[model samples]
Target: MPVLSTVGGSGRSTVAGLLACALSAMGSTVVLDTGPRLSSPWPAWSSEPGTGLLSLPPDRPLTRGQVHAAASRFPAPDGGSWQVLTDHQEWSHPPLPLPSDPAAWYQLSAIGGWQAVIADTVHPVAHDVLTARWADSTGLTARWCHLPFSVPVLCAASTGSGVLALQTAVKAASAEGLPLHRMVVALAAVGEGRSPASVKAAATMLEPRVRAVVQVPYDPRIRAHGIRDTSRLKSRSLEAGRQLARAVVSSAEAAWGDPLPAAAVPRTRAAAQARVHDTARIASKKVPA
Candidate 1:
């Protein structure tokens, strides 16, 4: 099962949304908002009807039929064939309690041929549930961890509390042996303005656990028109998001020992090397060289 864990500022939701669009554009019928209430303001599914997570009974054990029903609820956007499944529930503003049978629910979802499941999560809850589920599900593996570029307003609002929370969560997940694939660091800026250094700093702190760090240039159009659909984004943002998603997918495939398409492997390797080169350059510049 393809699972993407997006951990960053609130904008992670938007990143997840863009990924869903990218997957759809690639002709994979995707399930967006697989987790409980969506954190980002972007639309969970594509314009196609019935492509989102199924709202299920959180308090009770979910029956197979209930699971199937939930999957059936989402129709393909093109009225074509597709699979469905339930993601985590969005209970409240902060976060809801983990479902009693998270493993079973995750397994049931995996039965469907879900190419990807992007989860937008908060700190402790995101880490706890994903780790538990990954350990339990023989089929499930983490594809990537997304971190959006830090916005000054968001930083001021977070007041350093968010960074601390992220660090703590990453430590906890690592302790639990969660395989963190890649970390996509988004820089949501207007023009030539650089992404906040704090964002890169946070990503650097996560490097040991996060195998890759991708820089996604910020696009003002996403905020202006409220980029709910991938088509709504400029070509640049869409291409950037797609590249990040591909990296995440490659990381997951490598971890599982699954063979990837020959054409894609070289590009992924090149991207990884580029990241190492960029990090080395940045580090060299930072020193008294």
Candidate 2:
């Protein structure tokens, strides 16, 4: 599952961590960070930096061990640890040497011993899809967001603009033939107060379009410090995480059966070439090379 945001600063990564923590507490899970690593917080979550995706060789077939070696594990609720795949490299240059292909990451998830994989994406995927960006996208967005089994968790802050952004994303997904009925809209509380009438009204309009609209309370610790020890987090906040996880799992089942498709992971050479030419034809916006 991909935890995607409609806009930047929607607490997208934080929401992804919450989902990963909750999901890992149940069973094996790997939370892969595919966002811009320079701005990503996954590297700081662990004391020792993970090898990440760049550590894996793209030419060779991926294995569970290779993926595990690249990931850094974090403590979970049930005496287990959740693996996180992210680039923790230190760079002061033009671009980071991330794998050009995004499918390798997905292939690892299918092969790796994990019950769930939460991909924290950076771009506004719904908007891109609605705009036909997928036709040209050769990056992570095209691979995961369009996958049959990948249930998307669209996030937004619980405010006027946030709610409006989320509603717009929902409409975009519907327009792109995405499974909106099986999509979960995560409305995270930005502050402590009753939601504005506009937000409430927008959420009401959104209820019938998507599977469920859930709220995550604002935690002061997260605001001040950042995502660290879950034990230090408020109980209500943890409960909200559980609620969001349940909703995501249910959506997956409804959209793609109990066990999601294990195939359709590998991107063919032909497809890659097509995306490249198409992207060049439309715009110079190619994914990290």
CA lDDT scores, all candidates in order: 0.44, 0.75
Deviation (Å) of 115 in candidate 1: 2.3
lDDT of 1 by residue, 161-227 (tens): 4455555655555554554443433433334455456765776765565645555556676565554
Provide TM-scores for the models.
0.53, 0.82
Candidate 2 yields a Cα-based lDDT of 0.75
Candidate 1 wrongly placed segments (more than 4 Å): 1-9, 25-27, 32-47, 51-105, 122-164, 181-192, 224-227, 260-289
Candidate 2 lDDT, 178-246, residue by residue in tens: 777877888888889888888788888888988888888898987876666676788787788788899
Candidate 1 local distance difference test against the native: 0.44
TM-score of candidate 2 to 2 decimals: 0.82
Clashes by residue pair, model 1 = 34-87, 35-88, 36-88, 36-89, 36-90, 37-90, 50-74, 149-186, 189-218
Residue 264's lDDT within candidate 2 is 55
